[model samples]
Target chain A: MPVVELEGVTKAYDGGVVGLQRASVSIGRGEFVFLVGPTGCGKSTCIRLLLKELEPSEGEVRIAGKPLSKIPRKRVPMLRRNVGTVFQDYKLLPNRTVYDNVAYSLEVIGEGRDQIRRKVPDILRLVGLSTKLHAYPDQLSGGEQQRVSIARAFVNHPPLLLADEPTGNLDPETSIGIMQLIYRINRTGTTVVVATHDKEMVDKMRRRVVELREGRIVRDQESGLYRPDESTTEFAIRLRGELGIGAEGHPN
Target chain B: MFFFKEALRGLRRSTAPALAAMLTVLITALVLGVFIPIVQATMGAASDVRDRVVVDIYVAEGASPAERESAQRAIERTANVRSVEFISKDEALARAREKNPRAFREGSELLGSNPLPASFRIVPDDPTKVGQVVDRLAPKGPEGAREPQLTAIDEVRYREEDTQQILSVTGLVTVVTGGLALLLVVASVALIANTIRLSIFARRREVEVMRLVGATNWFIRWPFMIEGVIVGFTGVALAVVLLTAAKESVLEPLSDRWAFLAAPDTIAYPLLVGLLVLAGVAVSAAGSGLTLRRFLKV
Candidate 1:
C-alpha cells in the first residue's frame, strides 16, 4: 500500500492565504521522497498536512491508505505513534538525559521496563551516543542533539518517518551525516518523506522530488534536481525583455 | 506509577516555575488567612453592637398590675422583640440610685414618693430591625400622625439616630469586606494559573517532543496536574502553618490584652485551614490542566 498520499489537497490559511492548492502526490511503502521549495511555498504546510496538523481546506490526505480526516482528534496521538518526525529545531526534551530522551518514546507507548532497558541503549548506540547517554540536550553539540532527536524519533521503529528540515540547523558536514543516517533508516523499509530547501543535499540524493511554488505543485520529477533545469531562465528572459533586451539577448 | 514518577521528575526538572507557583500560592493563602479572621471578628463586634440596640416601653402610673403584665407580654410578642425585661418602678429607682449614688443621696431628703415609671426593656432580634420593632409598637395614622400600635400605657424610647448610624456603617463595612474577600479569591486563582502558563511556556519544547512521539494529551497532562497539586499543597500547607503561628504568637496575645478585640465566634481555625488547603490544590491543579489545553492543540 502507498504509505503517504495527498490527493487534490488544498490548504488555505487564515486571511485568505492559500498554503497549498490541489496537490496530488503519492509515495509507496518504503519509498523515499523529497519535498523541495522556496520558503513560504507550502513545503511545511504539505508536511503539516500529512502529519494531520492542518486539515485540508479541500480534498483529502491519506497515510497508509486511511484518510487522516476520519481519525478522531483524541486518536491523533495513536496515528502519530505509527509515524516518526524530526524537525529543524531538534525538539529534544531539554530536561531529560540522552538515554531518557530516547527511552521516553517507548515509555509513552507503554513498553515494559525490561524492554525499555533493552531498547533504549541499543537505540542510543545506533545514534552513536552510547557514551553520552546521561548528557542533557543542552550539553550536546548541535549535531549531537539532532542525533538524539533522531534516535528518539526512530526508536519506536515507526513505519513512516517524516522529516521537515532535519539538517536545516546543522553545518554541511553535519547535515550530510544526518541525511545519511536518515537514508540508512529509509533502507530498512521505512517510508521516508523529507521536506527541505537544501539544494546540494536534494540534488545529491536525486530521489523523487516534489517542488511547490505559490501554493502549487509546479514540479514532480523522479531522480530530480533541486531546481527544474530551466525554471530560472524564463524569469531571466522576462526581466531582460522588460529592460529592452532583444530576443537574441542584446539590449536593443 | 509512570504518571507520578513523570510528575516528580517534571518538578525536579523545572524547579523555578514550580517554586514560583508554590510561593504565589503561599503568599495569597497567607494574606487570605490573615484577612478572613479579621473580617469575621469585625463582623462579630458589629453584631454585638446591633444586639445592644434596644427599645424601652413605659407603662402609665395608674395602670393596674395586670395591665403592666399584659403590656410586657405584648412587647415580648411584638415582631423583632427578642426579650423583654419588666423593670418595676421600685427596681428602676434602685437602678437609678446604683448608677448615680451621689445624686440619689443628695435628693433623698426632697424625695416624697417613687417617681420612676415602670418600663419594659425590649431587645430586638436584629439591630437593623430596631426601627421595625418601634414601628410595630407605634403604628402611624393616615396623616402620618404618631399613635400607639399597641395598648402601651405611656411612652416609647430608643436612640433612633444612633441606631441608624450604626446600621449604615456596619452595612458599609460588610459590603467592602465581602467585596475584598471575593477579589482576593479571584486573584489567588489567577496568580496560580498565570504561573502555570509561564512554566508551561518554558517547557514547550518538552511538550513538543512528547507530541512528536505520540504521547496522548492525558499522558502529558497527568504529570503537570500532579505537579501543580504538589506545588499548591506545599505552598498552602506552609501558609497554614504560618497562619497558625501568627495567630498563636500575635493574635492570641492581642485578644488577651483587649477582650473586645476577640470575636465571640469566627471561622474555626481547623475549618479555615482545611478550606485554604482545598482552594490551593484546586486552583493549582485546575490552572495546570486548563492552561495545558492551549499547548496540547499541537
Candidate 2:
C-alpha cells in the first residue's frame, strides 16, 4: 500500500482562491519523490495539506492508510509525530545548541533522558554534525545549519520525511551535500517527499518528479527532468531554444 | 521534568518581565494584607464602642422615696435590661465632684444643696437592644414635651445620635474598603497577565516551532504555567515578609498610641499569612493561565 496518497484533493481559500485543485499523488513506502514547481504552484500547499495544517476543500488525504479528515483535532500532533519535516530556513531554536535542537524532537514526545542521550549524538553523526553538536544555530554556516535541521528532522526516525525547499538558500556545492544527505536518509526505508524549485538538482537526481503548474499537477513520471518535453508547451520550447540544446532525456 | 526545566530556562531568559510580574503580585498582596487588618480593626472598634452605650434614667428631685424606689424597680424589670444600679443623691454628688473637682469645690460654697439627681444606670442584654429597654422604662409623653409623662423619671438618655453615627461610619468604611479591594484585585490580575503576555510574545516563535515539532498543547503550556507559579510564590513570600515588617514597625506602634481602638485579634497570624500566600498563588496562576489560553492556540 502507498504510504502517502492524495485522491483528487482540492484546496480553496477565501474568495475562491485555488491553492490546489484535483491534485492526486501517491508514493509507496521507502520511495524518494521530488515535488517540483514554480512559486505559488501549490508545492507548499501540498506539504501543508499533508501536515494537516490546511484542510482540503474536497477529496481525501491518506497518510499510512489513515484518512486525514477522520483524524480528530487532538490527534493531529500524533500524525505529525510520525511525519518528520525539514524547512528551507532551517528553523532551529536560536537559544538551543545543535544537540538540544535535535534532542527537542524526542523531548517533546517525552522520551527518557537515556534514550535522548543515545539518539541525539547518533543522529548528529548521521547528519555529519557530530563536531558541531555544542554550537548554536547562529554560530554555524548556512550549510551547517541545514545539516542541523536534517539532524533534528531525522532524530525521531519517522517513517515519512517531508522536506520543503531544504537547500533553497544554499550554493550549488552545498546543495549537493544536502541532496546526498536526503538521498542517504531515503535509502534507510523512509519515504521522502521533497518540494523544491532547484531544476539542476532535480535533473541530476532523476527521481520520480511530480511537476505542478498553476495549482494543477501537469506532469508525473519516473526519471523525469525538471522541465516538460520540448513539444508539450511553448515555455519548454522557448527554454530549449534559448539553451540551444536538442530534446534529450537526462541520463539515469 | 522537561517542562519544569524549560520553565526555569525561560525564566532566566526573560528575567525582566518575570520580575515585573512578581512585583505586581507583591504589591497586590501587600495592599490586601494591610487593608484586611485595618478593616477588621475598624469594625472591632465600632462594635466595642457600641457595646459600651447604656441608658441613664435620672429620678426627679421632688419625687418621694417610694416613687424613686418604684422607678428603679421598673427599670430593672424591663425585658431587655441586663442589670440596673441605683445611684443615690449623695452618690451622684460624689460622682459629679470626682468628674469636676475644682468646679464642685467652688460651686459647693455658692450653692447650698447638691444639684445632681439620683439616677439608674441600665445595662441591656444586647447593646443593639438598648433603645428597646429605654422605651420600655421611659414613660411616653406628648410631642415636644420637656417633662417625662411619669413624674418619678426626670430624663432618659442613651446617646442615640452617637450610636447612629458610629454604625453609619462603619458601614461606609466596609463599603469603601470592599470596593478598593475589588479594584486592586482586578488591576493586579491584569498587570500580571500583561507581564506574562509580554514574555510569551517574546517567545512566540519558539512556541510555533514547538507546535510544528508535534508538541502537545499541554506540553507547550506546562512551562508557562510553571513560570507563573514560581513568580506567584516568590512574590507572595516577599510580600509576607514586607507585611511582617510593617506590622512590627507601623501597626504595633499605632496600636500602642491608640489604646482605645484596639487591633483585631480574631484572625491568627499564621492563618492570615497562609491565606495571603494562597491568594497570591491563585491570582498569579490564574493570570498566566488566562493569558496562555489566547496564545497557546496550538
Q: What number of clashing residue pairs does each candidate have, in the order they appear?
A: 0, 0
Evaluate residue A181 in candidate 1 and report its C-alpha lDDT on the 0 to 100 scale.
83
lDDT of each: 0.86, 0.82
Worst 10 residues of 1 chain A by lDDT: A243-252
- The model with the greatest TM-score is 1
Candidate 1, B49-130: lDDT as tens digits? 7777888888877889887778787788888888998899889989999999988766765687777889888988888888
By summed lDDT, which 10 consecutive residues of candidate 2 chain B come out lowest? B259-268
What tens-digit string does per-residue lDDT give for candidate 1 at A87-152? 999888888899998888998899999999999999878877889999999999998898888888
lDDT of 2: 0.82
Candidate 2: segments with Cα more than 4 A from true spot: A230-252, B39-163, B250-254, B259-262, B265-269
Q: Measured against the native two-chain assembly using Cα atoms, what DockQ does each of the candidate structures obtain, in the order listed?
A: 0.58, 0.49
TM-score of chain A of each: 0.90, 0.90
